[model samples]
Target chain A: GAGVSQSPRYKVAKRGQDVALRCDPISGHVSLFWYQQALGQGPEFLTYFQNEAQLDKSGLPSDRFFAERPEGSVSTLKIQRTQKEDSAVYLCASSSRDRGTNEQFFGPGTRLTVL
Target chain B: EDKVVQSPLSLVVHEGDTVTLNCSYEVTNFRSLLWYKQEKKAPTFLFMLTSSGIEKKSGRLSSILDKKELFSILNITATQTGDSAVYLCAAFKQGGSEKLVFGKGTKLTVNP
Candidate 1:
């Protein structure tokens, strides 16, 4: 695809169940970002990957949330023991360069609903 | 802690009208500010303002940043139905690590 892509556009999981969201950033992009957006709220930063390195994860809400980008191309966010509050749209973005002025391209995002 | 706040949580206007959305931020080591437009899915990039008093423009959309006031405003002229979306403002904090803090976003509705 020409732009960023996310898998499982919509996912419904029961409480306490685990879920994994996938993101395929723009090819050869050096910076990838994960953000969580709740209803009527702006997307909140979750983590950032510079190439294959997981440099920042301070925005992650809890230990149950984990993300990885082994090849520096694809990334995955895993939520363990999900609760109702964990339900939100997970968005992925990729930027061409690692600078303050780089504009990020975003994917369609995965809307997760915890029942 | 860094924070970004957007004013006029929601606005409704007829087509061809102009609207201005406001964003204010308080962050240590501010580097840049960005604006995005989100509809049903992900947000699309709009503009990035680093230097104060300079306006960035794309078609009918334009934005300007005020460093002294610690605020920015997104202006949409001749609004169309397609322009209806949530406009987001985010600030990048520069220091040991780089992080972007986003505001709540302002929802705009354009009626035909």
Candidate 2:
């Protein structure tokens, strides 16, 4: 079976440009999560979803970061007015159940760079 | 806020040696502690400990959690070069939609 996957493995955007990253969770996965990982640092949680409902978005740094899973499968993370500080690897993970219980399978991640 | 701290930011050991990595956390609504190994890519889950004083072992790797002391330890016996990677410790909180907070991680290098 296919594992979690993210599109645009590498993205280079102008400082003021906007970018959108996509995530495709494993089939039948009920839980999805997004995280941001800086170089030489651990992943920082950004948002989580259960099916089509957004359960948590507390870790989002600012209003420029927005995420949605409209149909309960694919998810999109949008960042408006990208800044240098926003350059990092955006990771997506999925689990069969809620994250608190099941092991999360991660994707290759999208490396976003603000030039 | 929940915080997970991993000690000895980096370690270097030779093959056939043993190494121990430590993790301590302060989290609200404590739930479970998890360990992960990362190479150049995504992290892969190792063990998840929700009970104290219980050892979870897999091959040459073993981990134990100490809930009373709010700490955990991962031990690797007979270290091999393949074990070289960044070890991340994460704490999961129950409330507020089950948050998982990760540590800065400890890098381990095994020389053959």
TM-score (all chains, Cα) for each model = 0.97, 0.96
User: What fraction of the real A-B contacts shows up in model 1?
Assistant: 0.62
Deviation in angstroms for B41 in model 1? 0.8
Across residues B32-74, which tens digit of lDDT does each residue of candidate 2 receive? 9999999877888999999999999999999999999999999
* Model 2 pairs in collision: none
DockQ of 2: 0.64
Give the DockQ of candidate 1: 0.67
Could you give candidate 1's per-residue lDDT for residues A1-115 as a string of tens digits?
7999999999999999999999999998988999999999999999999888998999899999999999999999999999999999999999887655357789999999999
**Which residues of candidate 1, in runs, are more than 4 Å off?**
A99-101
For candidate 1, the TM-score is 0.97
lDDT (0 to 1) per candidate: 0.93, 0.92
lDDT for residue A54 in candidate 2, whole number 0-100: 96
- Tell me the tens digit of each residue's lDDT in model 2 across A1-115: 4899899899999999999999999999988999999998889999999999999999999999999999999999999999999999999988887555547888989999999
